[model samples]
Target: MHSSAVFLIEFGAIILGLGLLGRIAGRLKFSPIPLYLLAGLAFGEGGLLPLGASEEFVAIGAEIGVILLLLMLGLEYTATDLVTNLRTQYPAGLVDAALNALPGAAMALLLGWGPVAAVVLAGVTWISSSGVIAKVLGDLGRLGNRETPVVLSILVLEDLAMAVYLPIVTALLAGVGLAAGSVTLAVALGVAGLVLFLAVRYGRLISRFVSSDDPEKLLLVVLGLTLLVAGLAQQLQVSAAVGAFLVGIALSGEVAEGAHNLLSPLRDLFAAVFFVFFGLHTDPASIPPVLLPALALAVVTAATKIATGYWAARRSGISVKGRWRAGGTLVARGEFSIVIAGLAVTAGIEPSLGPLATAYVLILVVLGPLTARYTEPLATRLSRLTRRHRPDTSAGDAPPALASEGPALTVDPDTAMSGSATHMTLPPSRGGS
Candidate 1:
């Protein structure tokens, strides 16, 4: 009973602190994620003061946070949108995978963390934070831009990929045999296909069943259904987050919008807690040694994400500015990166992996918004500056006709009367002359 009091106090304080941090972030036009993570660090195991009473509860909340994150993400798109994005943007998805995934894998191998770790890290780097990117697109008033669709397409592909990737990672981290892993992978694929099929074929019916005139009942039903599916997905060696995502995709039209509206507050609260929970597990001291590598990895992957967005937007025939905007918008990796790292941390894959991911995410999540807001303008400014500073070789240099030894007489003063006849055909002069 006494311990319960402490848990309430600790948990209440966490909520209050997150609220304050979020308020400050809003005022300053910054991401509240870094602040939330820092708060967790201060109260984490190896930090200033760890909370024993609430750690277990925080862990549970963190899991729900991930489920809600994916669920809310799914609510944004219908099965048809996902299918459309996949069809037209698959090549871009391949480019995204190649450019972004390889760096994390190389870094993992360089750190001698082996193949499993490489795969985990590859995923960590490959996915951009949809939550963060959505906010960016909204905040920057680019939601309706031409390149927005391009960005969304790449993100959808990544999310769909996670439905497969997470299960493989789970099997790998669990040290399952090839047969077991194959089964797990196959099950994940089957479930994903089944969900999409149901969504596309009978989405209206599914939504009709969940739909409610009462917001409260609607909220409860959707949330309960998501949690149930997520739990089952976990039991089947698939990711709860993936299940939650599929649940989101299954709901369409007004049902999705209503659920999104109702669940958004909960999503924000739990998502913040989720970030904190991640930080609670990552030791602050472990970050310094890995800081340089994290910084380097962040820089490399930031560029790669930008490139992925740019290339995709270009392929979609977006203008140069829109391409730059798409690239910048994709630069931020937040919740999903931490989610991937948290799994590895839980499995005890590598001790330093958690801290490295923590530092890397801290850098990028904070930088993500700024990059999204500024990347296009900055790139344009740099290009203009470069052109301005470039050496003017044209100054005091020979004219085109005069520069060539093949011609001596250039413009005919008589022909110069007409603009089109300004330049006249000229014969070569004698070499001696």
Candidate 2:
């Protein structure tokens, strides 16, 4: 009873604090994610205060947060959208992976963390925060922008890659041999393929099966199904997040819309907790020691992400401003980065990875929104300045003038009438005939 009382008080305070923080962020026109992380830091191991009873509960909530994050992301598009984006935007995805992931891998190797840590860090840098990006899009009213599809396509491909990447990382961290790892990878791919196929073919029927007029029933059914699939996927050495995402992809139409509306609040609540949980795991003192490296990684990856987005958007024929927005929007690395680092930290792969990731995410998450709002305009200003200073070769050149006698019309000679007025006269010819 005493423990229960303590749990209630602690959890209640945490939620209330989160709500207030969110309110403040909303008023200030800022993301509440960094604030949540700060709150967790304050309540975590080396901070001003720490909670004893509610930690475990918060941990569970954090896991749900991640599952729901991925689930809702999957709900945002249909199976056809996913397949089409993969087919058409795969080059962008590849460019994204190559540009953003390399710096982290190189840094890990420079830090002497070995091949495993390099791979883990590469994943950390590769994925952008879908939750954050989605929120930014809604906040800034960029959901309907020309470049938004390109952005979503890249994000979807990253999430899909995570479905495979997480399992492989898990096997590697566990020291599984080649044969065992291959089996794990194969299982993950097979399950993902099967779920995708079902979603594409029978999505409507599946939606009907889960659909309910009652919001309560709909909510319960969708949440229960997601948790069940996520659990089973985890049991099979695949990512629980992937399972939840696939479950989301399998539901469309009214069912998806209803589920999205019903689960959005829950998603927001759990997602906040997840960010806090990430902060809870890191010690404040450890961050300063790794702050330099984290800052360096953040800066390098930020530019690479911008390049990746610009290239992708340009390829898709998005305008200059839209391409800049796409690049800036992809700069924030949040949930997935933490998720990847959490796995490495849990496996004791690298002692410093956690703190570095914490600091890195903090820097980028704060910078992300700023960049998204300003990058395009800033680029435009710089471009104008460059053009102003550029030498004008065209100033010395003159355009050819047409004959002043009258307006001249050019016609194709191949289709012109033979010997019948090659060029029309302004006035009818007098006695020249």
Candidate 3:
């Protein structure tokens, strides 16, 4: 058999496997990431059918995947939504990312990994799976009113942060040591980004001129800008994902709709390829040894993030039930974790670390959705317990009712007492009633 034909056959098989597994996972109410990983394991190296794609090709495919994913992410933006909802959501996101990540990083260190590996792992676990959380909550119709804005804001914030976070992690892992040179390079990159922002901000005038004359031209311009920025960021040793995100943010302030439409096809194609390729790269056999540690880290990751979100929501004076629901909704990790894990591998971590990270992600993806499913019942019970154990209200007895001089308004009108009263009124009710 020709090598090209064999490669095509394997790739085709993997793609079909991904779609089938995704559908199966969805029907079973499980997160699809784990299933996708399984699909990869099934057809990838060391599996039933071994693949022959070079790591270099997979790496390039992954890069394209990140960009396209970011581009699609841009399409879901609304400034008014951000302004109205992100005020509180941003803080929760920051806290969730920080608190959840620190403990995970510490755990990684305790496991005898390098600091860079630990930080990378921490960042991966820190991010919540906004896509999954929103889908679950939206399906349940719980993502409305107060919870909607908070969750939306957090999702947007996480998306934006992933841009910066991806680059930082990549640099850290790529031997950009925590020395003065690295720090200087980082600062310079930041300044360049600021300059680019100012240029794009002012360039809106030019954009208006172009958009007014021709909408298609406007889209082309935005596309060019996105690629340019994304390319420049990569040139500067920053993550292209960060650059792509900035492109979205900048274009977000102007021509966002057009930018999204222009990027959509490209993004979709890349994203599909990314997920399928991601599956191909992961090997299930590599996950067994690290299963226990990954599980422990997954537990810590879920617990800390869930608690942080709950605490943050409670501080906002939300009911305990709301806190738990919101917390559970925020427990899932997202693409950022995979991106970080990839960086970790690129940065010279032990071969085992990549598979371990994959294992960690698979566990979280499974656990995250399950948490969403059971959150309501758990929250209801917890809230009930909290109410029952309150010091202000004694258990096993109803609190005293407020005394009223007037008759009570009961649903039953047969016992009503009224004298020339046109309104429907109920009779006087007893203390028990």
- Cα deviation in Å at residue 225, candidate 3? 4.2
Candidate 3 TM-score to native: 0.79
lDDT of 1 by residue, 374-403 (tens): 998899899889988999787577676665
TM-score of each predicted structure versus truth:
0.89, 0.90, 0.79
Best candidate, lDDT-wise? 1
Tell me each candidate's RMSD, in Å, in order: 12.7, 12.5, 10.2
Candidates' C-alpha lDDT? 0.87, 0.85, 0.64
Give me the runs in candidate 3 sitting further than 4 Å from their true place: 53-58, 78-91, 179-225, 258-268, 385-433
lDDT (10s digit) by residue, model 2, range 44-118: 989889879999999999999989988887787677877877788889989999998899999999999999999
Indicate the TM-score of model 1: 0.89
TM-score of model 2 vs. true structure = 0.90
lDDT of 3: 0.64
Among these predicted structures, which one has the highest TM-score? Answer: 2
